[model samples]
Target: MKKKVVPYLLVSPYIIHFLIFIAFPVIFSIVLTFHKWNIISPMEYTGFANYIRLFQDTLFLKSIINTLIFLVIHIPLQIIVALFLAEVLNQKIFLRGFFRAAFFLPVVVSGVVVTILWQQLYGFDTGLLNKILVTLGFGKVGWLIDPKIAMPSIAIMATWKNVGLYIVLFLVGLQTVPKHYYEAADLEGATHWQKFFKITLPMINPTIFLVVILSTVGGFSLFIEPYILTGGGPLNSTLSAVLYIYKQAFFYYHMGYSATLGLFFALIILSVVIIQKKFIEREV
Candidate 1:
C-alpha cells in the first residue's frame, strides 16, 4: 500500500495539471458546443443550433475554403523546398552549419515578429519585392492587399517560416539511409537523380509522410500570419478557420458557438489526417 501510494504521490502533479488544463477544457468545450453562453451570462441550451448555423455561416465556409487553399499550396512547396535544402545540407560543403542555422533562424523567431517583417516586405508601394520589380521595369504587385494574391502570399510566407524544421526532419531521415545502397548504385553507374529516386526516396517515405501530416495540420491551424499580416482580409481571402473561431469567441463574445466551431475544426482535422494516413501508408 505504501509503495503504491508513494508512486501515485509522485505522479500527482502531472495528473492534477492534466485534469485541470487538458481534460477539463476538452470536456467543458464539448458541453459548451451544445449550449449558448457568453462569458458573463448563464448558459442556455441550444442543442445543434450552433452547429447548424456554422454550415450556413458564409464566413465560416470561406475560412474553411481559404484554409484548404493554403494547404494545397503550402504542403507541396514545403516538401519540395525542404527536401532540396536537406539534400544540399547533406553534402560536404564549406559553412554547412552556418547555412543550416540561417535557414532555421526564422523558426525560432516569434510568429508575430515574422508576420510583421513579412507585412513590411509585402507592403504595396515601398515593399522590397515591389521595389525590385519596379527597378527591373515591372509594375508593383499587391502581395497582401489584393484578394487575388493575399492568401497565396501568406501561404508562401508560412512555407518559408516552417520549411526549416521539415528540412531538419528530412536531413535526419536522409542520414539514416544506408550509405552502402548509394555506393552500390554508384557502382552500377547510376546518375544522382536515378540514385535519389531509387534509393533515397523509397527509404525516406516515412519521413515524407510525417512532413505531410505535420504541414497539413499546421496549415489548418493557421491564424497568426493571416491575423497579423492581413487581418483575414482583402475580402476575407486569408481568413483561416482558427482565426474565424478566434473572432467568434473573443471578438464577438459567442463562446458557445466558438466552442462548436473548435470542436468541428478538430473533427475535420482528424478526418483529413485519417485519410492522409491511409493514402500515404498505402503508397509507402
Candidate 2:
C-alpha cells in the first residue's frame, strides 16, 4: 500500500500546528487546573481543592448570578430588536445596503473601543441618556453608577453594540424565505399576525437559535464592558465570570483557581447549549 505524498505533506502542517497551538495548550490548561502556581514558585498539585472552593466563594457566586442577569436582559433584547429591524429592512425598502452597513457597523468596531464609547454614553453625571431623560421631564438617573442598575446598564450597552450584527444575520435568514410563501398565505386569506406566526416565525428558527447561542456565550464571557465602565461596580453588581477569572489568574496570581473557574464555566456553557438544542428539537 502506498500513501499519497501530496495529501500527507499538505495535512502535516495543519497537524503540527494543531498539536502545538491547540492540543498542547488544552491539555496543559487541564493539568494546570489541578496545580497551584504563582509563576515564581514551584507548581504544587492540589487535586480538586480549587474547584471545591468555588462553592464557598461569594465573589464567584455573585459573578455567576450577574452573568445570568446580563444574559436574561441582553439575549431577549438582542433577538427582538434584531428581528424587528430585519423585518422592517426586508420590506423592499430603499437604501438596503446602507441600512445593513449602518446596523452592522458596531460589530466591526473593537470591543474595547465600543465599551469606551458606551461608557461615555452611560456616564452618570453628563451622559447623553441622562440629558435626554432630563429634557423629557424624567428624573436624571445614574445609569452606570447605581449598584441596582449597573448590570442592567451594561447589558443595555452590550445589546446596542452587538444588535447590528444579529440584524444582518436575521435579514439574511429572512431573505431566504420565498416570497411565494407570503403570496400563498395571502391567497389563503391569512392576516399579518397569522402569516407571521405560521410562516415567518418557524422559518427563522435556526437564525434565532444561532443568535441565542452567541448571545448566551457573550453574556457568560462579559468582562471588558463592566470592567471599563464600572470596574465591576459601584458595588460588586456588575462583576462577571471572566472578570473573576482574570482576577484569580492575573491580579491575584491564583492560576489553579482561575483554571478551575474556566473549566467550570465551560461546563456551564456546554449545559446551556445542550438545553437549547433539546428545546429547539422538541419545539421543531
Candidate 3:
C-alpha cells in the first residue's frame, strides 16, 4: 500500500494539471455548446440552436471548404518533401547537421513571426518573389490578396514551416530500416526507385501514418497564418475552421456558438483520424 501510494503521489501533479487544464475545459466546452453566454452575461440554455446556426452559416461552410483545400494540398506536399529531405540527410554528407538545423529552425520559431515574415515575402508589388519575377520580365502576381491563390499560398507556407518536424520523424523511421534489406535488394539488381518502393516505403509505413494524422490535425487547426497574412482573405478564401471559431468567440462575442463550432470541429478531426487509421492499416 505504501509503495503504490508513493507512486500515485509522485504523479499527482500531472494528474491534477491535466484535470484542471485539459479535462475540465473539454467538459465545460461540451456544456457550453448547449448554452448561450457572453463574457458579461449569465449562461442560458439554448439546446442546439448554436449547432443549427453553424450549419446555416455560409462563412462557416466556406471556412470548412478552405480548411479541406489546405489539407488536400498540404498533407501530400509535406510528406513528400519531408521524406525526400530525410532520405537525403540520412546519407553520409558534409554539413548534415547544419542542413537539419536550417530546415527545423522555422518549427522552433514563433508562428506569428513566421506568418509576418511570409506576409512580406508574399506581397504583390515589392515582395521578394514578385521582385524576382519582375527582374526576369514577368508580371507581378497577387499571392495573399487573390482569392484564387490565397488558400494555396497559405498551404505552401504551412508546408514549408511544418515539413521540418516531419523530416525529423521520417529520419527516425529511416534509421530503423535494416541495412541488410537494402543490401539484399541491391544484390537482386533492384533499381533505387524499386528498392525504395519495396523496402523503404513498407518499412516506414508506420511513420507515414503518423505524419499523415499529425498533418491532418494541424491543417484543420490552422489559424495564425490566415489570421495574420490574409485576415481570412479578400473574399474569405483563406478562412479556416479555427479562425472562424476565434472570430465567433472573441470578435463576435458568440461564446456558445464558438463552443459549438469547436465541438463540431473536434468531431470532424476524430472521424478523419479514425478513417485514416482504418485505411492505412488496410493498406499496410
Q: What is the lDDT of residue 15 in candidate 3?
A: 100
Reference-based lDDT, each prediction: 0.93, 0.88, 0.92
TM-score of each: 0.95, 0.93, 0.91
Q: Model 1 off-target regions past 4 Å?
A: none
- Candidate 2: stretches off by over 4 Å: 1-3, 188-190
Worst 10 residues of 3 by lDDT: 227-236
Candidate 3 ranges beyond 4 A from true positions = 1-8
Q: What tens-digit string does per-residue lDDT give for candidate 3 at 70-146?
A: 99999999999999999899999899999999999999999899899999999898789899999999988899988
State the displacement of the C-alpha of residue 212, model 1, in Å, after optimal TM-score superposition.
1.0
Candidate 2 structure quality by residue, lDDT tens digits, 22-104: 89987888998889898889999998888779888998889989999999999998999999899899887899899989988
**Model 2 clash pairs?**
none
For model 1, residues 1-284, the per-residue Cα lDDT tens digits are 79879989999999999999999999999999999998898999999999899889999989999999999999999999999999989999899989999999999998899999998899899889999999999999999888989999998999889989999999999999999999999999999999889999999999999999999988899998998888899899999999999999999899999999999989999999999999987997
Query: Which should have the higher TM-score, number 2 or number 3?
Result: 2
Q: Highest lDDT among the candidates is held by which one?
A: 1
lDDT-based ranking = 1, 3, 2
Give model 2 RMSD, 1 decimal. 1.9
User: TM-score: which candidate is best?
Assistant: 1
The TM-score between candidate 1 and the true structure equals 0.95
